[model samples]
Target: MRPDPHFLRGGQGGFGLVAAMFVIIVVAGAVAAMARMSETQNATSRMAIQQARAYQAARAGIEWGIHRALAGESCSDTFTLEGFAVAVQCDTGAAVSLPEEGRSPRFVSLRASAQYASPGSPDHVYRQLSAVVEKDD
Candidate 1:
């Protein structure tokens, strides 16, 4: 006996239903991936800003140390700024590094470092910077 035409028509629609479901799943996955990418980009930008701030803070420490060194400050001294502590060290002769001859006329070198409490962590972040300054001589 031949099968009913209506039963055969019902079977034909099954392929189209499965294909539609697959397309919907793929679109949802694509959207989820884009959201994750956006979050990562935002995190990168925040890290860059933090690094720039750290660099600036380190520079400030260097400048302060150089000023004190030019005035004949001793080594192992500390300078404080915005809850950060800067340690200064000075040396002379071969022990100390001076600017290249005829470069900037600076005879003394100063090294400064700053330590800050890490954000949302038990650790800390420290940065060091150096500069060469000219003596009154």
Candidate 2:
């Protein structure tokens, strides 16, 4: 009539299996979280690149418009550059009267906007640029 020590040890058998399963679940969760973070980081990087490209396209459009305005050419058009669509608008303002030097100058306003995106995609980027140029009249 003795209480067997082996009986208590038998209950400990399932403990190892439970601990192993818990470790496996924790590792899996960590791996999944890391994967998600990497994806997000990649997406952010891509968006940043797209934004830079759009900005460059808009800046180019603004320069083009300014050049055209200074050359006395009308500026109003849309074009594509580096995978982005750029729109430009430019106009010459009233001439400045300088009586002392007997010279007149005109101010040309130029604006450009660029956009890049795929249809129905959330990763869209846009940029705008404005400039003013002075021309002798």
Candidate 3:
């Protein structure tokens, strides 16, 4: 309702509005950046947990192979655990005779691998392990 003294004279006006707009833009940008950073951190944490789980899965596979070999069975399997794909392969070596000790010893070798996702994926996790055990007759 007041007379437009600055508008008629074409004087500078709306400085407060301009300042408010700048502040809003800056605040919006800051909020977006924080959100992006938080999302990245969350993703990293999930990947780390997946990595550890994959390792455990692979280790379990190795142990399973050793157990089967000790029980006089061939070991080879593919399975899934906790969203991870696990594979184990085993090889049994020829028996070695020990005449001096009156005993024959056989060795079993195992290899295991665990994968959380397809290869080359951003969140993929993988783990591999190898073990050798003595199979006493």
Winner on lDDT (2 vs 3): 3
- The whole-model C-alpha lDDT of candidate 1 against the native structure comes to 0.69
Query: What's each prediction's clash count?
Result: 0, 0, 0
lDDT of 1 by residue, 20-75 (tens): 99999999999999999998888778766655666677787677666666677654
Task: Please report, in order, the local distance difference test score of every candidate based on alpha carbons.
Answer: 0.69, 0.89, 0.92
* TM-score per candidate, chains pooled: 0.63, 0.90, 0.85
Better candidate by TM-score, 1 or 3: 3
Residue 89 accuracy (lDDT) in model 3? 99
Minimal lDDT window, size 10, model 3: 5-14
- Arrange candidates, best lDDT first: 3, 2, 1
Error of 1 at 3 (Å): 9.1
Query: What C-alpha lDDT, on a 0 to 100 scale, does residue 46 get in candidate 2?
Result: 93
Q: Write the per-residue lDDT of candidate 2 for residues 6-35, one digit (tens) a residue.
A: 886886767889999999999999999999
Candidate 2: clashing pairs of residues: none
lDDT of 3 by residue, 1-137 (tens): 89877678675567789999999999999999999999999999999999889999999999999989899877999999988999999999899999999999998989999998799999899999999998878
